[model samples]
Target: MQPTILITGATGGIGIALARLLKDHAQLVLLGRNPQKLTSLQTEFPEARTEALPLTDAQAVQALIETLPALDAVVHCAGEVVLSSIQDSQLEDWESMYQSNVLTALVLTQQALPQLRASRGKVVFVNSGAGLRASPGWGGYAASKFALKALADALRQEEPLISVTTVYPGRTATDMQKQVRDMEHAEYQPEKYVRAEDVAQAIKTVLDMQRPSVIEELSIRPG
Candidate 1:
């Protein structure tokens, strides 16, 4: 039997690409918010299951994971990036990032722990380079990314049996980039953008590795 993989934020961008990349081999389940997007993706891969739910809803997140039959891996790619200077950053924006990036990942991890342990599965985090460094006007996004990275690091240390891999993908070509460009005045030119499929392939490679082998951190930046 093919191993089952659970993915969050699977309706778009990196998540969507990863889903498609893995669909040929794995039993894939995707979680997202848009019904139309989920419907469209499900049509493309009828073998994959779609769960339309916001990550912020704890009850919904818990229910979704608890009902899953089994899982061999989980890729968390559901997140938002809102940029603002530290001085001008609203509490609301910071809260939004925390809820979407930090809390949601934690909730999902907690909910999936049982299934993961049952399979001795892997947990892959779609983190950013911002998670590793700081820059002016990157306070909000950077802080959230750092927290997310820390969570994966801590998990890896505590659960050595379950591979915890964090992939820092630099400025991927996606709608998120457009949002960041508009909100932060940061022009993410295509010349510098890493194709989402490249990141997807990296993930598939990591998953294909032997159980004893582990990739703790992977950084993919455009050359």
Candidate 2:
């Protein structure tokens, strides 16, 4: 049987690219926050399941997982980014960053652990390059990503049955990247960055890897 994969942030650039690539290969369970986008995805991937779930809501995520009989993979593509310096950043800024970038991944993964262990599934976190280092104006965002990396690392150690991989992609040409450029007061050049499809292809590689050798981490950058 084809693997049953759950992809969060299914409406985002990388998520959409990945879903398009895997539509014929796997049973997709696309989860996103925007109801309208989820509707569009339902039309787009008629055979795939779609859910408009708030991943941060532990109760909601648990309730959703209760419906799934088998899940082979869970790819976390949902996240947010905000550029702020130490002096200008507000407390809520950090809180929101953690909530979106870190908590959602944690809550969803925690709720789905039982099935993952049963299926010996894969967990992929679509992390950012900022996760490895903190730029001047990117401290808050980086901190949250760093925390996400920590979560992935601990999961890798704790859940030996399930392979955990963190993918760090450099600036990609997406709407989010455009917003990031606008924040930096720079030009929005989609052509200069990595394509979302490339990232998706790399993720497919991770999910397809066979036994005895798991991809613990992967880093991708623009050419």
Candidate 3:
């Protein structure tokens, strides 16, 4: 049987790229918020199951977890980014980023732990370079990503059998990166940024890693 992998943020650039890359060979459960986009993608990847909902709701996540009979991996790419100096950052933006970046992963992973343990699965967190270091206007988004790193680190130590990998991709050419560029008043040059498919390919490498070893963390910057 093909390995079953559940990927969040399925409608996003990197998410869609990864789905296309894996759909032919893997069983995919793609979770995202945009119903129309999810429906559209379902048509393209007819074999993949699509779920449309907010990941912040623990109850909804719990229900989803119960429906999965078997799962081999989970790739968390669902997250939000906000740009602001420490002095100008809004309380709500910080909270929203935390909920989107950290809490969603927590709820989804917590509910799926049983299946993960049973399968000795892999957990991949799609983090950002901001997670490693903060810039002047990146405090809020950076903090949330940093918290996500902490979550990945703890999961690794606690679930030794289940491989946990955190992938930090630098400024991928996604809509989110365009938004960041707009906020920064810089020209949005998609060619100047890393390619989304490259990030997706890197993730495929992580999942292909075998027993007796695991990729703990990977960081990619534009070449």
Show model 2 residue runs off by greater than 4 Å.
none
**Against the hidden reference, what TM-scores do the models get?**
0.95, 0.98, 0.98
Query: Against the correct fold, how does model 2 do in TM-score?
Result: 0.98
Per-residue error for 5 in candidate 2, Å, reads: 0.4
Give a tens-digit lDDT track for model 1, residues 1-223: 9999988889898999999899889999988878998899889889888988767677887788777788899999998888878998898998988888888888888778888988999999999999999788889889999999999999998886689999999989998888988876667687688999999999998888887898889999988
Winning candidate number (lDDT): 2
User: By TM-score, how accurate is candidate 3?
Assistant: 0.98
* For model 3, the run of ten residues with the poorest summed lDDT: 53-62
For residue 122, what is the lDDT in candidate 2?
A: 97
lDDT of 2 by residue, 1-223 (tens): 9999999999978999999999999999999989999999999999999999888899999998889889999999998888988999998989998999999999999999999999999999999999998899999999999999999999999999999999999999888899899999999988999999999999999999997689999999998
lDDT: worst 10-residue window of model 2: 208-217
Clashing residue pairs in candidate 3, if any? none
lDDT of each: 0.88, 0.95, 0.93
> lDDT (0-100) at residue 206 of candidate 3?
92
